[model samples]
Target: MKNRAILIILSLLLFIIVTPSQAQTYQTGSYQTGVGIRMGNTGGISVKHFMDGRHAVEGILSARWGGIGVTGLMEWHKEAFRTEGLNFYYGFGGHLYLGRYQRYRRNYYYESRGAIGIDGILGLEYHLPRAPITGSLDWKPAINLIGRTGYHEGGLALTVRYTF
Candidate 1:
């Protein structure tokens, strides 16, 4: 009986010492905003600003199809109910395209197009338990509101950022 009581007391003391240390190691930040360059054939500089705790606004300036384009986006983020260290986000936005394209016949086609439409994003982000690095993957779908009439585009991207 005395041995069992000693063992229980030791276990309780160990739990009391370790619990606070584990809780203290979970570090999170707020209102993260950043800008960075994307690497790809259709890549650009992107900026994202977080609003409140679960919403964000984003903008991108990219070159595509020999034209320069700009996009505006809004996103909402939520913590995954059953997962730790995971967040899911979604949102919408618009874009404008400018510049020119060359036809197969060697003719030059100049375009000054503007598109205003909705965007949907589904993504998962993981924040390192006490670290400043965040990693994410997301899919974005956008619909064109101007030239091409009923054109739409969808893409997936990976993101990494350092939180402050």
Candidate 2:
């Protein structure tokens, strides 16, 4: 409980720290590729690329609930409230999970018991004009289809990436 509060606070602080004020001028052209770390409901590494200013693809490799998994998303972006480097995005994706579970005091093989799910993401991202960094806050909820069938509405995360 306490740790969760701290995590929320820290995420908010990162958002505040990364937000830019008006009167700041960004470079004429921003980079297309980025790599970063994501922390939240599940912690992991993320890679993203902008095919253009408004369309992008992101990939995530992470561990969730003590299990390793990977996800890929295709997102659409739009400017945020007149902020030059700020944008809001939404996307759809899927995930593959390789996990192990104990049942009735027995250990099961992970390969034989894996989960697959569809994911949806919505987030706000800020690209630092003068630095090679970007910050984002997002909610990524998923519905499990294989192994476990249900809706998981708990996918909120904060990410920071080095854009190049």
Clash count, one per candidate: 0, 0
How do the residues 67-152 of candidate 1 rate in per-residue lDDT, one tens digit apiece? 78887888766665545667766665777777554445347554444444555555687776777666667766555556644434
Deviating ranges (above 4 Å) for candidate 1: 1-31, 39-42, 104-116
**1-164 per-residue lDDT for model 2 (tens digits):** 54564455457546644665332333213879999999998669999998866678999998865678899998877677777888877777898888764344246533336779887777899988899999999988776789765677656899999989
What 10-residue stretch in candidate 1 is worst by lDDT? 19-28
Q: Pick the candidate with the highest lDDT.
A: 2
RMSD of each candidate relative to the true structure = 17.4, 8.4
For each candidate in turn, the TM-score is 0.65, 0.75
* Overall lDDT per candidate, in order of appearance: 0.61, 0.77
Among these predictions, the greatest TM-score belongs to 2
Clash pairs detected, candidate 1: none
